[model samples]
Target: MSMPEPKTAWRLLKSAGVKYVRFVIVDIFGRPRVDILPIDEAKDAFIDGVLFDGSSIPAYGGVNRSDFVAMPDLDSVYIETWNGGKTALIFTSVMDGSRPSLRDPRNVLKSALETVKARGYKPLLGVELEFFLVKGDPPMYADGGVYFDGHLLHTWPVLEEIMEHFHLSGIGSTKTHHEVAPGQYEVNIPAGDPLEVADKVLAFKILAKSVAQRHGYTATFMPKPFWGINGSGAHVHLSLWRDGENLFASVKEPREELKYAVAGILQNAIANSVFVAPTVNSYKRLVPHHEAPTRIVWGLGNRSAMVRVPYYGGRINRLEYRHPDPSMNPYVAFASIVFSAYMGVEKRLEPPPPVDTVAYELEGVRETPRHLGDAVKYAQESALLPEEFVKPYLALKEEEWLSYLKSEGDWEKTWNKITRWEYNAYLVNV
Candidate 1:
């Protein structure tokens, strides 16, 4: 069930003793803006929605027609994990009059999932988010631990608190541990329906940051927060199901449906890179020889390939897309992936054979687009991404790239330095 009616939802909250509600909406840049509501007004806010000036939100709208409303997706209502149940939080999808707003990230995903369900299938997703804990202006690592470090005494308490909040928020964690890089960490959450999974991903980021600050360190999801060290990435594990059976897995060979989905993703990989790695710094994490994928190829357990079919067979089998970073808007990112898979299923396309060797060194392999400009160009010209979505997205990305060009920072001063913009923009906010 998506959710109960607004009155029922508000009544449930009232029964739980929630005094305040925060209606959240994520913008194209992956920033969450909230509208606070008292318990008395929440029911009306849900039924009629809350008005906001869309022009004030970056890339949302212009002055000519900037008014928009945020109607809470009641299915997404949950107690604020960090706020002790006194407050509840719900996500919103922008609406223009009675129609879904094309500019809203949640609406984009919702529309795509509706199409997938109509085709008699559901998209299941398991997300792995990697981030770092640091402090200071330039930032010093919070811990010197390495991958699976057994002695992360300093980091454990923070992670424990973060995980506790996640559990309270109803976001189940399958695994959590330190990553290979200093102060880096990873969290694995159980798979679910596409929209719910995306919402959880967003919530996880928010809670992770909130809990980290409570400890005295800043948590960053910036794709490449530091130079000469491993960068963070949010790898998405994708699969499709129908009537509780995984369509991507078969008793014998990989299913034909799985093959088609891979083909669709590869077909649109370049164009959709903007959705996966949306920020300028994301390209810094895509360098070859790193764990990140830079080429458009699939493999079995190969970290260097764009997509990898893990060794797990049967119901657990799925495709892991390696390019996306936690910096992306999960709603839009998942929508693009599933919609691209739809194109593959519709065409019955076959993907190129999976390569077993190191794909980064493999000759004739197509590189995933290198820079934001190339990605923006490919996305604008893509036939798969509808004009309504691609148009505003491209405009926003273009402005981001141009802004970076005019920006003069420490990176420009040093021949090889990471941009300070990423540090200032994401270190505290993300």
Candidate 2:
């Protein structure tokens, strides 16, 4: 996709009758921060770029070197009608001096995409964003609906409003349905350019929260907000294209490239866990028997495996990575998946035989990291990501893990159940 010129962006906003423009940036932890400007001031910001303190954001910079600029990707401009169509939002790229910051989550994914493009392939991503809506201080489910329930539940109207917002914002939301757990819902974003898809995923979360709040509820992407029920997952559907052909498609069985990509993902599953199942509470959702992936294995149409090749046949065939939860930073998660898959293709790595039956019942298959500390350790030992990114990410995650430990001493005893401390720490913030 080509980026729009500054003049084009200014004209588009003016034509839309936008009174305020929001310069949006995603921090390392996947939280979005915004700076809103009146239309007149924003016109100048489009050319000069918006300056902010990078040190305030996690993993960006130190106090001494805190200067940074947010250069809006004009093509990402989207007008929101919730505020009477007066507010326009644009996703920005963080700039360190004159160059893009490697620490910027979006730029990391951009670098990974360029690497894939140089090897004659274009990657496409479709994301399924799952989250829950609740109310009250400790949080309670807003509805009693189950999977595919279409009843006129309290949460249904919120989902409808969110979808309407997505449509107005140019996000292609293909499907929305009630998930297995109460108050849980999922929205499927159609396959598109990886970067655009990531932006939509982030936008979906923000919109869901906004719409839910207007209805007197809170929307959370927390992986495991409650125990003994299914947790929210951000299942990613990935496909690779070269010369306008789907590289993973085949008539009889799985293709070699598909197997190699799965192998690369499985090989780095341990290290990649930090990016996918990112939060301290994310590990709680990776356990078996809750429709979540626990084993690092792949199979055809197997939901239990971390990587499952959906039987779509022909050009539509793709892999579904089920390990990731909505708590992840989509930009970094997609980048890690692309880099791992590319590594497999470059090395010709072969995946293990497909698990035909229940993978959780099978022994000997490698299990994903059981805790955030284990994920941090595995990431520290691997060279999967660049040193600059990996160093700060590990430090940030390590601190998070230590804080969790401090809050709930002896995690081994309380790992099975969601504690009050865990709920207080992550329920609202995540």
TM-scores for the candidates: 0.95, 0.97
lDDT of candidate 1 over 1-430, digit per residue (tens): 5569889988989898899998998887667898888999877997888899999997678899889998888888767768777888798989887899868888888898998899888898888899999988898789989999989888899988887888887777557889989999999867888788888888887788878888898888888878788888888989988898888876536788888998999888988899989987888888887799888998777788998888654333788899899888888889889888877877899999988898888888678876787789888777354577678888988887777766743333532357677676566665
Residue 413, model 1, lDDT: 55
Worst 10 residues of 2 by lDDT: 309-318
Whose TM-score is greatest here? 2
Candidate 2 per-residue lDDT over residues 1-430, each given as its tens digit? 5777787788888887999998889888877889999998888889888899989998889999999998898767777765578988789999999899988888989999999999999888898888989999788889888999989466778888887888887776567889999989998988988888888787777677878889999998999988889999999989888999988887658889889999999999998999999988999998889989999999988898899888654333788999999999899999999889888887889999998798889897789998999999999998476777779988989998998888888779778888777777677666
In candidate 1, where is summed lDDT lowest over 10 consecutive residues? 408-417
Total clashes in model 2, counting residue pairs 3 or more apart in sequence or in different chains: 0
Best by lDDT: 2
Tell me how many clashing residue pairs each candidate has.
Answer: 0, 0
